[model samples]
Target: MADFLGSVWWMIVSLGVLVTFHEFGHFWVARRCGVKVLRFSVGFGRPLWTRRDRHGTEFVVALLPLGGYVRMLDEREGNVHPAERAHAFNNKPVWQRIAIVAAGPVANVILCLALLWAMFMVGRADYSATLGPVQGMAASANLHPGDRITDVDGRPVQSWAEASIALTLAAMDRRDARVDVLGPEGDDRHATLPLGQLPAGFAEQRVPELAGLSWGFQQRQAIVAEVSTGSPADGVLMPGDRILAVDGQSVDSADQVEPLIAALGRRGGPGMVEVQREEDRLALELTPRQDASAPGGWRVGVAMSAGTAPAYDVRAQYGPLAAVPAAIREAGRMTADTLGMMKRLVTGNASLKNVSGPVGIARAANASAKRGVDWFLYFLAALSLGLAILNFLPIPILDGGHLLYYLIELVKGSPLSDRVMIAGQYVGLALLAGLMGLAFYNDILGQLPR
Candidate 1:
C-alpha cells in the first residue's frame, strides 16, 4: 500500500512539473508575440486554485495533474472583438507563430539539461560496470568474468547504467563497437563486440543478458528470509538467522547452502547446522526433510536472501561549474539515444514493448524516488528528453505539427484551408490514439507474469 501511494504521489509530482514547464514555454512565447492569453492551466477538469492577473489571463491549478494547456485568444477558436484583433494568436507573424509553437518542446529540452546538471552536481551513486559472467557475444569478443568495462566506441563509461545504454544502442543499430576493459588480472584489454549479431528476439531479454553480460556474480549472505510453517526449518531456523554451515561444511552465500543441506538429506542422518543468530554463533542438531517439490529433491523449507541492488560502489559527482560540460554531454547523448530508439521503431528493429505508458512511468518514478534525489533527477531528465522528442515528431495536433503548418504557410504565403486543417486534426487524433493504445497494451503486458 505504501508503494502504491508512493507511485501515485511521485507520478503526480513528475507529471505536474513536466506539464507546467511545457505549458509555460508556450504561454511565455505567446504573450511575447502579442497574443492575448486567456487561461493558463496546469492539468484539466475542475480547478483547485485559480487567480486572474491584471491582464485578465486566468491562471489555474486543476485537479487532474495529467496535462496542462495554455489557451490564447485566437480568431479561429472563438470570436475575438474587432478592437482586439491585433492581439489574436492568428494575427501573429508566421515566424512568431513558429516560435510560439516550438517553445514547448524547447522548454522540455532545457529542463532536461537543467535536471542533468543538478543530478551531476548532486552525484549519482551506482555500481561499477563490471562483468560477472561472459558468454555468447561477450565471449566471442574475448570478454571475460571480472572484466570492468571502461570505454565503448571511444566513449568512457563508469557505471552499468551508462555502459548499458551505449551497448544497447550499438546492438539496435547492428553496429560493432570497440570496447576497452580492465581484465581480472588488472590487464587492459580491447575488443570489438559483435553487437550486430544479436538475435532478432533480443527484446525478450534484458539488454545485458541478451548481449551475454551479467552485472557481476552478486553474493548474497545466507541469512534466512522466511521459513515455511510446520516445516523442519520452521522451528530449527528463524528468519534473520545467518546459516554458517550445513552438515559441518562451511557455507557463506545463499547459493552455497542449498547443495550442502541437500547432501545432508541424502545421507539420511542428522547433521550439525551452524548458524549465526544475532549475538550468538551456535551448532544445532537438525535433519533436512525430503520433498519432491524442493530443489535437488530435498527441503530446508526456508527462503534465503534473494540479493538486492548493490550499494553505490562509486559516485559520479562534480563541482557545479565542472558539471556543465558533463551535463551538456549527457543531454546530447540522451537526445541521440532517444532519436535512435525512434529510428529502431520505424525500422521494425525494436518491439512495441519498448514503448511504455503511464504505468511504466509511475513505476520508474517511484523506484527512482526511493533511490535518492540524484537518481530521481536523472530519471526526470531522461523522461523530459523523451517528452521533448515525442512532442517534436512531425504529426498533426502536436507542437511539431503546428510548426509544420506555419512552415507551409510561410512558403505558400497563405494558411491551409479550414477543411484541410480539420482533416489533419482528425488524422492526428487517430494516430495519437493508436500510439497511446499500443503504449497501454505494452504496460499491461509488462504486469502479467512472464
Candidate 2:
C-alpha cells in the first residue's frame, strides 16, 4: 500500500508539472497572437480549484492529474462577434494557427533542454575502472587480483566510469575487450580479455534485468532479507543469514552467488547451499523451486540487499556558453530515441508492454528522484521531449490533427465539412481511448513482482 501511494504521488507531481508547462505554452502563444483563451486548466474532470484572471480566462486545477489543456475562443463552437472573429482560433490565418498549435510542443522541448543544461552544470559522480578488485578464480590465470585498469582500446581513461563504458560498447560486437592496465611499476600493460557469453537457451533473448553489465564498483555481502514460507530457503535459510557458497564455489559476496545459482539451474533439483549465521557455518541440501516470474532461471526465493556505490574521484565538467548547445544536442538525441521507440510500437516490432501509463511513469519518476536531483531532472527533460514529439504526431484530437485539418483546407482551398470534422473527432477519441487502455494494461502488468 505504501509503495502504491508513493508511486501515485510520483505520477501526480511529474504529470502535473509537465502538463501545466505544456498548457502554459499554448496560453502564452494564443495571447501573443491576440486570441482569447477561455480557460487554462491543469487537469481534467471537476474543478478542485478555480480563479478567473483579468483576461477572463478561468485558471483551474481539476480532479484528475492525467493531463491538462488550454481552451481558445473559436467561431466554430458558436456565433462570434465580427470584431472578435479576427482573434478567434478558427478564423486565424493558416500560418498563425500552425504557430499556436506548435507552441505547446516547442515549450516542452525548450524545458527539456533547460533541464539537461542544468544537470550538466551541476556535476555528477562516476566510477573509475580501477575501483573493482579482481577476484580469485577469474583473476588467477592471466590478470593479477589487484591490477587496476587505466585504459580501454587505445583511449586513456582518467576514471573507471569512462573506461567501463568504453569497454562495454567496444565489447558489444567483439569477442574480446582490450584492456590497458597500470602495473606495479609506472609501466602500462595490455590484455585482450575474452567476453562472457550467455548460457545456451538465453542467447538472442533480451531480458530487461540482464540487458547491461554492471561494472563491479561495489561488492554486496549477501544477507537474507526474507524467507518465503514453505520454500527451499525457508527451513534452511533464515533472515539475516549471510550466504557463503553454493556447491563447491566460494561465494564471498552477493554478486558471486547470483552467477553460481544461475549456472546451477537448481529448480526442482537437490542443491547444496552454504550460509553463515553469526559465527556458525551451516550447509543444507534442498530442492529449489521454479519461479514463473524468472523466465529462464531457478529461484530459492531470497532477496539480496544492494545500493549505489559512491564515485569519489570522478571529474566535473562545466562551460557557461557551450553548455546550452550541448544540452540542446543531448535533448535532441533523447527525443530521437523516444520517437524511435514509438515507431517500433506502431510497426508491431515492439509489444504494448513497452507503453507506460501514469502508474509506471510515477514509479520511474520516484526511483530516478531517489538517485539524485540531477537524474530526476534528466528524466524530466527526456520525458518532456518525448511528450512534445508524441503530441506532434499526426493523430486525430491532437495538435497535429488540427494542423492536418488546416493543411487539408489549404490544399482544397476550403474548410472541411462540420459532419466530416465531427467524424474525425470521434475517430481520434477512439484511437486515444485504445492507446490509454493499452498503456494502463502495460502499467498494471509491470506492477507484478518479477
Candidate 3:
C-alpha cells in the first residue's frame, strides 16, 4: 500500500508540474495580448483551492488532476462590460489569438528542451557501440563479436543509445541499412543489415530486441565473481576463478560462455571445465542445475565481475551555448520519433499494445524516480515532448482542434457554424473516449499473467 501511494504521489507531482507549465503559457500569452484572463486552473471539476488576484484572475487548484485549462474572457461566452469589451479574447486580432492558443503546447516543447539541457549537463553512463558476439540472423552478415560500430547508413554514432535509435528508424522504414564497424584486429568493415525482416509493429516496442542487428559493449572476462549457495556452482566454482573453457570448447569472452554452459546444463550430465587460477590451469568436473527463474534453461549460478566497466562512461558535457543546440536536436529527434509512432498506430502498422494510459505512466514515474534525479528528469523530458505532440494532433476537444477551427476562420473569414462546431465536438469526444478506453485496456492487459 505504501508503494502504491508513492507511485501515485510521483505521478501526481510530475503531471501537475507539466500541466501547470502548459496552462501558464496560455495565461501569460493571453494577458500579454491584452485579453482579460478570467481564471488560470490546474486540473478540472470543483476547485480545491481558489483565490482571485488583484487583477480579478482566479487561480485554482481543482480536485481532478487529469487535465487543466486557462479560461480567458471572451465575448462569445457571455456578456462583457463595455469597458472590458476591447480586452475580450474574441475581440483581439486573429494573429494574437493564434499565439495565445499555440502557447500551451509550445511551452511543453520549451520545458522539454530545458530538461534535456540539464540532463546533458549532468551526464550519464554511455556504452561504446561494440558488438557482443553475433547470433541468429546477425551471423549471416559476417559480423563478429568485439566489433565497434562506427556508423549507420553514413550517420556517425558514438554510443549504443545513438546506434539503437538510428537502427530502429532504419528498420521502421524497411530500409536495408549500411552499418560500418571497426573490428578488434584493427580492420574496418561494412555490412548491410536487412531490417525489413523485423516483425510488424516491432519499432513501437521500447527497446525492441532486433533479430539481426544486435550490439553491446565489450563483455567482462568470464571470471567468477560470486557462486550461489546450494546451486551448481556452490562447490565447483569459486570467486576469482577465470573460466577458460567448458566441454573442451575454448571460451575467449564472457558472452560466449553463457550459451555454452546452458547447452551443457540442458544435456543433464556432468561437464569438464577448464579454468585458470593464479597462473595455473585447472580442470574441474561439475553438473549444471536448472534455474527456476528461466524454465528450460540451466545455470551454474555464477556472477561475473565487470571488467573495465568504468571505461564506458563517455560523458560529453556542453557549455550553456552549446547545450542549447544539443538540447534542441535531442528534443527534435524525440518529437519526430513520437510522430512516427503515432503515424504507425493510425495506419495500423503498429499495434494498440504500444499505447500507455495513466496507470502505465504512473508506474513509469515511480520507477524513474527510484533510478535517480537525472533519470526522472529524462522521463519528464520525454513525457513533455509526448504531451506536446499529442495535444497538437488535429482532434476536437484538443488545442489542435481549436487551432483547426481558427485556421478555418482565417481562410473563410468567419467562424464555423455553431451546429458544425457542436458536431465536431461530439466527434472529438467520441474519438478521445475510444482512445482512452483502448489505452486503459492495454494497461490492464499488461498486468495480467502472460
Candidate 4:
C-alpha cells in the first residue's frame, strides 16, 4: 500500500510539472505573438483550481492530469469582440501561429536538456567497464573476466554506459563489435564480438548485457556476507567465512557456490562444505532448505559478500558555455534513438512491450526517487525527451500536424479546408486512442506475475 501510494504521488507530481511546462510553452508563445490567451490549463476535464490573472487570462488545474491545453481567442471558435479581433489566434500570421503551436514541444526539449545539464553538474555514481566472467563465445573470443574494456573500435569508454553505447553503435551495421581491453595481468588485447543475429532493439536491450558475458565489474569472492535466521545457513555458516569447496568440488568465485548448494537441496542430502575461517580450514556438513517462493527451489539463505564495482565518473561537468552544445547534442541523440525505436515498431521489428504507459512511468518515478534526487531528475529528463519526440511525430491532432498544415499552406498558398481538418482530427483521435489502449494493455500485463 505504501509503495502504491508513493508511486501515485510521484506520478502525479511528475505529470503535473511536465504538463504545466508544456502548456506554459504554448501560453507564453501565444501571448508574445499578440494572441489573447483566454485560458491556460493543466490537465483536462473539470477544473480543480482556477484563477483569473490581471491580464484576464484564466489559469486552471483540472481533475484529469493526463494532458493540458492553452485556449486562445479564436474568431473561428467564437464571436470575438471587434476591438480584440486583432488579438485573436486566427488573426495571427501563419509563422506566428506555427511558432505558437511548435513552442510546447520545443519547451519540453529545452527542459529535457536543462535537466540533463543539471544532472551532469550534480554528478552521479557510475562503474567502470570491467568484466567478471566470460562464457561460451565470449571465452572463445579470448575475452576474459577481470579485463577492463578500454575502448570499442577507436572510441574510448571509461564507463559501462559509454561502452554499451559504443558496442550498440558498432552493432548497428549487423557486424562485430571491436573492443580493446586491458587484462588483470597487465596485457592489452582486442576482441571482436559477433553482433549479427541479435534481436531487434538489441542495442537498447541486449548490448548492455553484453550477450552472455555473465560478467560483473568486481570479481565476487566466495565469502559469506550474511545468513538469514531459521534458514539452512543460520546454524551452519557465519559471515566472513571463505567458502573453499562443496562436496569435494573446489569453488572459485561466489557464482560457483549457489548451484552446488541448490543441487544438494533438490537431491535431499547433506553436503560436505569446506571453509577457511581465520587461517583454519574447517569441514562442515549442511543441508539446503526449500524456498517458500518456489516449491522446488533450494536456498542456503546466505547473502554473498560481493565487492563494489570499480568506479568511474560518467558526468559531464562542463561550464555554461560548453553545457548548451553538450546538452543539445545529448537531446538530439535521445531524439534520434526514439525515432529509431518508433521506426522499428512500425516495421514490426520491435516488441510492443517496450511501449510504457502511465503505470510503467509511475513505477520508474518511484524507483528513481529511491535512488536519489539526481536519479529522479535523470528519469524526468528522459521522459521529457520522449514527450518532445512523441509530440513532434507527424500525426494529426498534434503540434506536428499543425506544422504539416502550415507547410502545406506554404506550398499551396492556402490553409487546409476546415472540413478536411475536422475529419483528420477524428481519425487522429481514433489512432491515439488505439495507441493508448495498447500502452495500457502492455502496462497491466507487465504488472502481472509471469
Candidate 5:
C-alpha cells in the first residue's frame, strides 16, 4: 500500500513539474509574439486553484495532475474585439505562430539538458564494467574473467550501465561491436563482441543477461539462502551454509557453484561439498541430480540472493563548467538512441514491450528516487528527452502536427482547410488511444512473473 501510494504521488509530482514547464514555454513565447495568453493551466478538469495576472492571464492548478495546456486568445476559438485583434494568436505571422507552437517541446529539450547537467555535477552512482565470467556470446568474443570493458565501438564507457546500453543498441541493430578491455593482469586488449549473433526471436528485454556478461562486483557470495524439498541439497545443505568448494575446487561466487554441481552429475557420483558454517569448516558428500528444469540439466536446489549489494564502484562526475558540455553530449547520445529505437520499433526490430505506460513510469520514478537525487535527476532528464521526442513526432494532434501544418502553410501560402484539420484530430486521437492501450497492456503483462 505504501509503495502504491508512493508511485501515485511521485507520478503526480513528475507529471506536474514537466507539464507545467511545457505549458509555460508556450505561454512565454505567445506573450513575446504579442498574443494574449488567456490561461496557463497545469493539469485538466476543474480548477483546484486559480489566479489572474495583471495581463488578464489566468493561472490554474487543476484537479487532474496528468497534463496541462496554455490557452491564448485566438480568433478561431472565439470572438476577438477590434482593440485586441492584434493580440489574437491567429493574427500572428506564420513564423511567430510556429515558434509559439514549437516552444513546448523545445522547453522539454532544454529541461532535459539542464537535468543531465545537474545529474553529472551531482555525480551518478554506477557499477564498474568489470567482468566476473564470460559465457555464450561473451565467451565466444574471448572476454575473460576480471576483464574490464573501457570502451565500445569507439565510445568510452565509464560503467556497466553505459556499456549495457551500447551493447543493447548493437543487439537491436544486429551489429558486432568493437570493445577495448583492461585485463586483471594490467594488460590492455581489443575485441569484437558478436552481439548480432543472438537469435532474431530473442527478447531484447533480456539482452544484458543473455549477452553472456556479468559484472564482477555484483556477484553474490556462495552462501545458500534456500533448499528445495526432495532436491539434491535439501537434506545436506542449510540456509546459512557458505559453500567453500565443490569437489575440492574453491568457489568464490554463487555462479561458480552451479557448474561444479553439474559436473558431479556427469561424473556419476556423489561429490564432496566443502562449506563454512559459522566458525566451523566441514565437508559433506552430495550428489547432483539431473533435472530438465535446472541449468545444464542438473540441480542441487540451493538458492542464493545477491545479498545486500555492495557500494557503487563507479561514478560519472563532472565539474560545474565541464558538466555543460558533458550534458550536451549525453543529451545528444540519448536523443540519437531514442530516435534509433523509434525507428527500430517501426521496422519491427524492437518489441512493443519497450513501450512503457504511466504504471511503468511511476515505478521507475519511485525506484530512481530511492536510489538518490543524482539518479532521480537522470531519470527525469531521460523522461524529458522522451517527451520532447514524442511531441516532435509528426503525428496528428501533436505539436509536430501543428508544425507540419505551419510548414505546409509556409509553402502553399495558407492554412490547411478546417475540415482537413478536424479529420486529422480524429486520426491522431485514434492513434494515441491505440498506443496508450498497448502501453497499458505491456505494463500489466510485465507485472506477471516470468
Candidate 6:
C-alpha cells in the first residue's frame, strides 16, 4: 500500500508539472497573439484551486492530474461580441492559430531538453564497461567472463551504459555484434555475439512490457542489504553476509544467486545455502519461500544492494552545452525506438500485453524516483518528449488534427465545415477512448506477476 501511494504521488507530481508547463505554452502564445484565453487549466474536471489574472484568464488547478488544456475564446463555439470577434481564436490567421496549437508540444520538448541539461550539469554516476567475466548463454561461445568490452559493432564503448544499449539494439537486428574485450590473459580479444533470439513478448505492441524486457549489463554481487522480517532469510542470513552459492551452483555474483533462488521452487528446498560474513563461511539448510511478486515460485526474504554493481568503472561529468546536444540526440533515439516499437505492435510482431495506462506510469515513476534523481529526471524528459511526439500525431481532437484542418484549409482556401469538424472530433474522441481503454486493460493485466 505504501508503494502504491508512492507511485501515485510521483506520477501526479511528474505529470502535473509537465502538463502545466505544456498548457502554459499554449496560454502564453495565445495571449501574445491577441487571443482571449478563457481558462488555463492544469488538469481536468472541477477546479481545486482557481485564480483570475488581470487579463481575465482563469487559471485553475483541476481534480484530475492526468492532463491539462488552454481554452480560448472562439466564436465558432459560442456567441461573441462584434468587438471581441477579432480576438477570438477562430478569427486568427492560419499561421497564428498553428503557432498557438503547436506551442504546447513545443513546450514539452523544451522542458525535456532543459531537464536533461540540468541532469548532466548535476552529474550522475555512469558505468564504464571495463573488463568483466561474461556469463550465461553468451559465455559458452568463447566469450570468457572478465573480458572488458571496449567497443560494440565498431562503436567505441565509452561507458557500460553504452555497451548495454549497443547490446540491446544489436540483439534487435539479430546479427552478430562485434565486441572488443580485454581478456583475463591481459590481451585484447574481439568476440562476436550472435544476438538474434527475441524474448517471449518482444513483438508485443505494448511499450512498457517491451521496454521492461530489454535487459542490460548489470553488476553482479551477493551482499545482503536488508532482510524481510519473519521471512526465510531473516534470522538465518544476517545483513552484511555475502551469499556464496545456492545448492551446488557457483554464485560468483548477485545476479547468479537470484535466478538460482527463483529457479529453486517450493519443492527444490530444504536446500543448502552458503554465505560468507567477515571472511567466515557458513552453510545452512533452509527452504525457500514463494513470493507472489516473482515468477517461477522462488523467493528469498532479503533486499539486495542496488544501482550499478561492481566490476564497472564510473564515468565523469558533462558540461551543460554538451549535455543539451546529448539529450536531444537521446530524445530523438528514444522517439525513433518508440515509433519502431509501435510499428512492430501494429504489424503483429510485438505483443499488446505491454500496453500500460496511468497505473503503470505511476508505478514506473515511483520506481525511477527511488532509483535516483537523475533517473527520475531522465524518465520525465523521456516522457515529455514522448508526449510531444504523440500530441503531434495526425489524430482528431489533437493539435495535429488542428494542423491537418489548417493544411486542408490552405489547399481548399476555406475552413472545413462545422459538421465535418464535429464529425472528425467525435471520431477522434472514440479512437482516443478505445486506445485509453486498451491501455488500461493492459495495465490491469500487468499487475499480475509475469
| Candidate topping lDDT | 5
Per residue, candidate 1 scores C-alpha lDDT tens digits across 1-450 of 898899989999999889988999999999888899999999999999999999999999999888899999999998999999999999988999999989998999999999999999999999889887577888888998779999999889999888888888787777787899998789999988887877777773477787778776364678889999988877889888899988878774677787888899999978999999999998988888998888888887889877675677879899999999999998998888788788888898777778889888999999999999999999999988888888998789988888888889999999999998999999999999999999899889988998
Worst 10-residue lDDT window, candidate 2: 202-211
| Candidate 3 residue pairs that clash | none
Report the lDDT tens digits of candidate 4 across residue range 1-450: 988999988998888878888889999999899999999988899999999998899999999888899999998898989999999998888999999999999899888988878776676456678776777656767988778889887877777766776676555546678789999898999987886556656544566455556445445678999989988778888999999998888776888787877777877788989999988999989988788663347888888897554444354567766767767776776776678778767866556777889999889999888877777877888888788777887778988877888878878888889998898888888888989999999899988997
Worst 10 residues of 5 by lDDT: 200-209
Better of 1 and 4 by lDDT: 1
Task: Check candidate 2 and list the clashing pairs.
Answer: 127-161, 128-160, 129-160
Deviating ranges (above 4 Å) for candidate 3? 1-3, 199-237, 247-312
lDDT of 1: 0.87
Per-model TM against the reference: 0.83, 0.68, 0.83, 0.81, 0.86, 0.76
Instruction: For candidate 3, write residues 289-323 as lDDT tens digits.
Output: 77766434778788876766436545646887888
* Per-residue lDDT value at 241 in model 1: 89
The TM-score of predicted model 5 comes to: 0.86
Ranking by TM-score: 5, 1, 3, 4, 6, 2
lDDT of 2 by residue, 1-450 (tens): 777787788778888888988988988988999899999999899999999989899999999998999988998788888878888988777778888988998899888888888887875445555533353322532454335677766756656545654554443333356677775565677776554342323322232113233234555667788878877677788888888888767675676665676666653467778888889999877566666675346677777766345455564446877778879777765665576667656765445566778877888898777768777887788788878987887787998788888889889988889898889989998998999998898878876898
List candidate 2 segments past 4 Å from native: 126-212, 221-317
Candidate 1 matches the true fold with a TM-score of: 0.83
- Candidate 4, residue 139: Cα displacement in angstroms equals 2.3
- lDDT for model 3, on a 0 to 1 scale? 0.82
Instruction: Quickly count the clashes in candidate 1.
Output: 0
- Go through the candidates in order and give each one's C-alpha lDDT: 0.87, 0.72, 0.82, 0.80, 0.89, 0.77
